[model samples]
Target: MTDSRRSSISSIKSDVKSDIESPELPLDQKHFGNTLDQKAQAQSKEQPSEETPSTIPNGGLVAWLQVLSGFMCFMSAWGMVNGFGVFQDFYSSTLIPDVSNSDISWIGSIQAFLLCSATVFAGPIYDHGHPRLLVMFGSVLVVFGMMMTSLCSEYWQLMLAQGLCVGFGAGCLFLPSIAIIPSYFTTKKAVAMGIAASGSSFGGVIFPIIFRRLEPRIGFGWATRAIGFISLTSLLIPCFCIKARAFPKTRRKLLDFAAFKEPAYALFSLASFVGFVGLYVPFFYISTYAKDVSGLEDTLSFYMLPIMSAGSIAGRIIPGLVADKVGALNVLGVCNLCASILGFCWIAIHHTAGGLIVWALLYGALSGAFVSLQPTTVASIT
Candidate 1:
């Protein structure tokens, strides 16, 4: 009986081992398949969640090309505005001799007003992928304005050409360059913008010298045509080069009133307005003031422009670097205060040559600070 029980137990153990080795147990098969599926699903989830790298190339041929394009655009547009002093002098002396300084001031004032005020509408339009059209239209208007201006023999005609047409054109051209910049670059944005903004200063330098030399040799018509040619050349590069990157597909509203919800923007706008009011007065009046009040020669007066512009070159660059460190608003506020003081000083020391020179130097330095700081200030607040 004992032998029979031992044999039975061995047989049962063998049967259990055979059952464990079989592949057709339904519960075990289901659990194994489920485990494999869970692992695969977890891996699939992780694969799609990986971050994408940026398309903005760091300091290569394409990057430099973008910088070059921006420089060209800015030089063509803002450069002309900086060269307004030459126009002011010529128009006041030749075309509208009867017009007072204040009366003639309207031309430049209107141009500046249109240039800035158009930002209200142009910003949204540019953000919407119409940059090429905007830039082309601006080029046409600027060129046409110059062409018409060369033919103008009257104050109103000049105003229409220089103030209305050129101003509007500049606004159109400038919006794209400014708007497209932030799209292409984030890390190198300041450097890129600085290089671009220098175009104005460069234009300021080149145009005055050109106007001074060419006004004597070629006369006003051909001199202007020369400037127009330079502008045309500079304007063309942006048409091909400036492009938006990963811009949103949705249409932005015509007016972004949402921008004003921030108190900082409102304050900046006010400060900018006040700063511009003081800023342009000197640029317009300095040559005349030097010629009439200080008894400087015409050539010397013209030379003052480039000198001030030279100061401005430093102004635009140095403050940009400082703004990154100390805060743009702090730098800008200090700049405005300095500009105001310098303006008062100019008014106070109108009769003395040394004082006037000091004022110019000081004012130019302050203006540079203001120019550099303003953009930084806007960026900071925005």
Candidate 2:
């Protein structure tokens, strides 16, 4: 069945040029033939006179602006998700002291889970060419959710506000930021995404510091609202900058259940899903865990999140640069193994300040690539 399906790719000798110039892809006869969209694009490039010239600019002033817009979008959405540790640690000690760690952890869990899973639905809508609307509605939901969060006093209230509202809002915004880039660039995809994905680490580093400073001066409610104001500004860029093609030549179905038929895609998707089960554990708990084990004052413990994020800034950018030269999957697979090793190390070293600090930095640096390269990994496969 696979050989029959791929008979056409073997006849297309022109693809060898791309294969030679680009980083190597994992081999399979059916995939080498190319997926439907890739085959269509290859044919167009091969026979431009018979088809319309592609208006999807690869790299230009406009393309770079979209990259900047995507960066800001990621900074606010995933950045806020990373900063959840500060809020989780604070709410447990001050706002909802009666709640169990497991219970408080769910707020961050739900937010992370929703933000990651949202791609399933959002991917199709972007294909439909409503990029601006998605960005606008997502902006509203994100800002409003943060504003509402300032007034919550109970666990359920916080969950609905931050976990449900903010999570979904971030999901809505996050998917578009990711989706719009491919509409603009191909050869530069790895670098463009790397720069945008770096925003999460930037946000992670900055927001924790923001919370640590403002929490005391303005109090908790206003401190959150202050973050909301920052998100409002960040969310605006993508709304105006990122755009869809004026005339979409093909429309894909919203969901492709048949994807389960392919072994590589199925297994990779499953691995990506399972990776998340443990993915955000440290991001959610590390700061509080550091305080409890090390007996540090509030001033010192909060810096741990920022430190982890600082290391992540390097992790996201450097691997992306290397992936373009080598292969994204090659980098992604190695990064995931390193991240898993760091996860095990998390279990043993909670007793000392230096140990906790060192572990957070190492783990953050390794894990950042895991977070950034997920989409690029899937892109390589399918």
Best model per lDDT: 2
The Cα local distance difference test for each model comes to 0.74, 0.82
Name the runs in model 2 displaced over 4 angstroms: 1-56, 246-250
**Which RMSD does model 2 reach against the true structure?**
15.2
Candidate 1 global lDDT: 0.74
State every prediction's TM-score relative to the real structure. Answer: 0.81, 0.83
Writing each residue's lDDT as its tens digit, candidate 1 over 1-382 gives 6999999999999988988897465888899999999999996654433222365554566666766776787677777777677778877898678987778878888887777777678777776767888888888988888888778878898889988998888888777776666555555655566667777777777987887799779888888888888888888888787665544445579887876778989877777787677677777778888888878878887776666666666666666666666776787678778878777667678777667666776676667766544654677678
Scanning candidate 1 in windows of ten residues, the lowest lDDT window is 45-54
Q: Which tens-of-lDDT digit does each residue in 268-329 have in candidate 2?
A: 98888898898778888878877887677777788888888888888887888888788889
Model 1: CA > 4 A from native: 1-58, 351-355
